[model samples]
Target: MRLRGRKGIRETIESQHDLVVLNPAEWKGRWAERFGNEKPIHVELGMGKGKFISEMSVLHPDCNFIGVDMYDELIRRASEKARAAAGREDGSAPDNLALALFNIERIADVFDEGELRRIYLNFSDPWPKKRHARRRLTHAGFVRQYVRLLDSRGEIHFKTDSRPLFEFSLNSFADLNIRLRRISLDLHKDGPAPDNVMTEYESKFYEQQMPIYRLEAVIGQEALAEHEASLALAERQP
Candidate 1:
């Protein structure tokens, strides 16, 4: 999946920053300070190819965004976009964006309990095979990690085109009893709800006339929900 014309500025710095990061904890605690602001934190997990998040940092200057992905090559592109935005160059993007190379399973180690204000899962792999259910981002294993990083009633926003994955996610959320805040079986026909923000994958899907399923789940008053715990971060964003 080689993208043409993506090497904007990270081309120069990517060699300097060691694009691949094994642990997110390095940048976890002071992620806020990374932007020189103590503002609210919102994260987008699986920021493929880097589009939605770079635009978000431009649109919302108040909130600091953290984009996490495991792939070093993809992260390099994201870093380029962030650097461009920060410098306000011709092909550069908006500032206030931080990219991290993190295993989503290590979310807790990246942020303390009740630290993050929100989480976004855009077009995550369904892992539809029964044996691979544990790999799904919305599965109990990942949900547990989210609870630790999430602030009280912190929300997890998700969107996907996979029906099986969406259904599985719904049942998993209820089984955990974290609280399903909003469930839209088909987001496009939801009668003018909140305007949907387009992610890179999302935009492609729409052009192909694909319908996206979406939902938002939140943490409840329960101290603990039906889920496991987390593993672990260092720093150096994607």
Candidate 2:
């Protein structure tokens, strides 16, 4: 759900410098230093409105969280939510969370190799058209970027209410021979796992009794080799 252009969206986002990262690329390889800690980092790509990441930051103070969205309006809203989650009325962000405006295609420029422990893709755009498949978050190209950013023990946690997208993502991972675990075709079949955090879209779908599909793709040695090979093949293409 893309929001309409709010009147001072850009100004609003710029004002929250403490919570929003204005230039993410400059902090590449130094995210832990940005947070002033050495805790593991988890990032949520395309974090719409930020209900999930905000809650996750509050729930797990031991890990640092970065919420990335391309829209200034969405980032602004997410910043307010983060502040509220931290119970700070003085506009300070949570110690463990940072929001950034980023285009996912250039994600590699913002994080160094093995910088992330986990990546979240919650209810991402399905991009139903065949020609647009490459734009999907779970596409092989994006997965390759994720593999580079994630450490050996890293994981990609993806949740979606769109069955077609779920199927596409599963097949994409399979083509790379990536290891997957905790796959649930109907994630809320037993009524919301205690450990599950719901995004705004997810909560709406859950209320309407929609089935959510989820999977965790683990980064293993085989996947690493495959990603490296793909990168080499791309380098040789032209």
Encode model 1's per-residue lDDT on 141-172: one tens digit a residue.
89888877887547788889999999899988
RMSD per prediction, one decimal?
9.5, 8.1
Name the regions of candidate 2 deviating beyond 4 angstroms: 89-91, 220-238
Each model's total of backbone clashes: 15, 0
| TM-score of every model versus the real structure | 0.79, 0.90
How many residue-pair clashes does candidate 2 contain?
Answer: 0
Candidate 1, which segments miss by more than 4 Å at Cα? 1-23, 83-87, 90-93, 190-194, 220-238
lDDT of 1 at 31: 71
Ten contiguous residues minimizing lDDT sum, candidate 2: 220-229
User: In model 2, which residue pairs have backbone atoms overlapping below 3 Å?
Assistant: none
Q: How much lDDT does each candidate structure score?
A: 0.73, 0.91
**Candidate 1 lDDT for residue 128:** 75
